[model samples]
Target: MISKRKLYYLLSPSMRYSIRKIYYFPSDFWDLISGKRDKTIPPKGLIFIGPGDFKRIGEHYLNIFKEQCNLLPNHRVLDVGCGIGRIAIPLTNYLNKEGSYEGFDIVKNGIDWCQKNITQKNPNFKFTHIDLKNDLYNLKTEQTANNFVFPYQDSSFDLVVLTSVFTHMMPDDVVNYIKEINRVLKPNGKCLVTFFILNEESKNYMKSNSDFNFQYNFGDYSLMDKDVKEANIAFEEKFIFNCIKENNLTIEKTLYGFWSGRPKNESFDYQDTLILTK
Candidate 1:
């Protein structure tokens, strides 16, 4: 029998997304009437990305931002792939009037729900819709991620974030985004991004099949699913480091995760988290 994940990827991107929304709609409807869901949280049917508990994961990142990234209430924040306000909701309570949040996503409905729900209460929080093409998430959009320019001024943000966005992107797209991150950040600004960094240690860990093994080799990067281009990508360590260096961004820290078979209890996240400074 074909595995469910492989079978799911066989369907077109539009069909895959529609099927997920449909699958989760009944529970979301029930939660709406029963008042089991929080106001800031998006309905399950509408959430297009990310894994694990929605509210908990958002709060978890908030803590990381405050504790690890030294995020301040008055600093400007940018979320590259703010899907359904998972990270934005927690930030609303944290950022004071002097601070602001800007997020953009390819999916229109997530942005619509966020603007209607979150932005109404917190005027400082804003969302913009950009229909960019990705193999797993979006396909019909005219714009390509590789050369897309961020609609923002240079040296504007104090902190930039890309939680799980790069994992779904191609190498060229990520390189361009890194350059954009360097451009948009103020002097000494910080960026906290996550990726699957394929270094020696991570390679050793992936010897077992239990972990997230990027078995399909594709030069500098590898894919979890061979045919599904954007399903999950892991970049070689040298390529990632070189990209950061070429973009004039310095690596501040590297926190490897448990996805490559490291002890789960010892890891902070499933993907390797890197803190960079510009």
Candidate 2:
């Protein structure tokens, strides 16, 4: 069987993008027609592949935060690129009344759903729609990624989490986000981010993997498909480490993931996770 990544390239870039949007149409239609789509449970078509994946990934992140970040019940949390409350739903039960949560994403539909569902009931959980331009997701925007300021006061959040976000972003944009994360983080605050780290080991592993390969080297990072650079971006490990430190965010720990073809026991998730503190 053809791998998903390989199959993704069979169509032109525009076609691929259109197909993805089209793929989600049925789920959106179901929500409109049946009213069966649970607001508590995000529609499976947007960020996740399966219905259970939303809870599964959210709980996994919660566990990681608790274990590595010492996440407390009263800690203020920020979910960057929070897609349809996949992570926020689980966090609602974990955070105490004193704690608050804020989430933002480039997609309007996800943000609208999250606002009506999550923030309406629990006012502490706020969601914002950032109309940032992205080839695959948001196509038009007045604000550029490097210049768009995070809509929060300085030193606001205790913990900031970004899952599967940087994997699709460019290096400069990622650095700008790191700087923003550093700026908004309270003293001793932690930021947990997931990335496709291109170290020597991972680089070698990708060479033999027919499913996905970071073939286009762009100095600081590599892309699986050159035509659609943002589809899957992987940064050089050293470059990312330096970028993080330069942004004043110290790397507390690095947990490698299974996307590099590492043995199941050796990897934690699909994307390598970095725990950072300012």
Candidate 3:
């Protein structure tokens, strides 16, 4: 079993640095953060591109963003798990001058990197460092002793997004975040989230691999193992639908295969994009 301390170590700044290198974040972005350069040029190449080539990978995420968010010029968007400004920066550009964007993450490095690079040109964009692992979901005005603050008032945002964030969270934490999203969202607001879903096909695929196991608890399902075991954490389609129902949100759309499941040539079936309206 993975302990909370091990998870913290994995998320530590030094470990994150190594992970970034392994993931091939732009060298200039790292150089700027390390004070090796006075100024840095934002990377133009696709950061998440795999052996499939850039155009194919770009089309995948672009379509996912468009279908999931249905982004508009006048929208106010909150990106709950903005990592290194991957989606948030590009999304700010996509929204142009008519919209406002805010992003928060558990990692300070991500927030700091975004503020330094993306927020420079997009003055309306903002980033905050918030530790969601702690029970600071309510985010009161005077509760400034935490790692960061959420300045916007309740029901201020038109959309809130938690892309690939729920895939790593415990089931209780996932429910809490759904409640918090409801609290921050306006009556007409929407939320877009992505996750790995464990259905029958996924279960069979895991069984074939012999390196995975599916664990089910009170309707919540996850795959657990030693190496890449945390990837096992997943939700049933009904669990997501029920969470939205309980929160009084309506499902707008669902997009499948954004990341293409395992057995690499399977054509991006692992990711699920959900758009929910309040």
Best by TM-score: 1
| Predictions in order: lDDT | 0.90, 0.83, 0.62
Task: Find the 10 residues in a row with the least total lDDT in model 3.
Answer: 134-143
lDDT per residue as tens, model 1, 2-86: 7777787789877877888899989988888998977778878777786689999999999999887899999899999898899
By lDDT, who's the top model here? 1
Off by over 4 Å in 2: 1-39, 46-52
Per-residue alpha-carbon lDDT of model 3 for 16-120, expressed as tens digits? 455646666566567668876433322332131113433344345546656656667677888886765656645654676777888887656567777988788
Model 2 scores a TM of 0.88
User: What's each prediction's clash count?
Assistant: 0, 0, 5
Give the winner by TM-score: 1 or 3. Answer: 1
The reply for model 1, stretches above 4 Å from the true place, is none
RMSD of 3: 6.7
99: Cα error in model 1, Å: 0.1
lDDT measured at residue 68 in model 2 versus the true structure, 0 to 100: 91
RMSD of each: 1.2, 3.2, 6.7
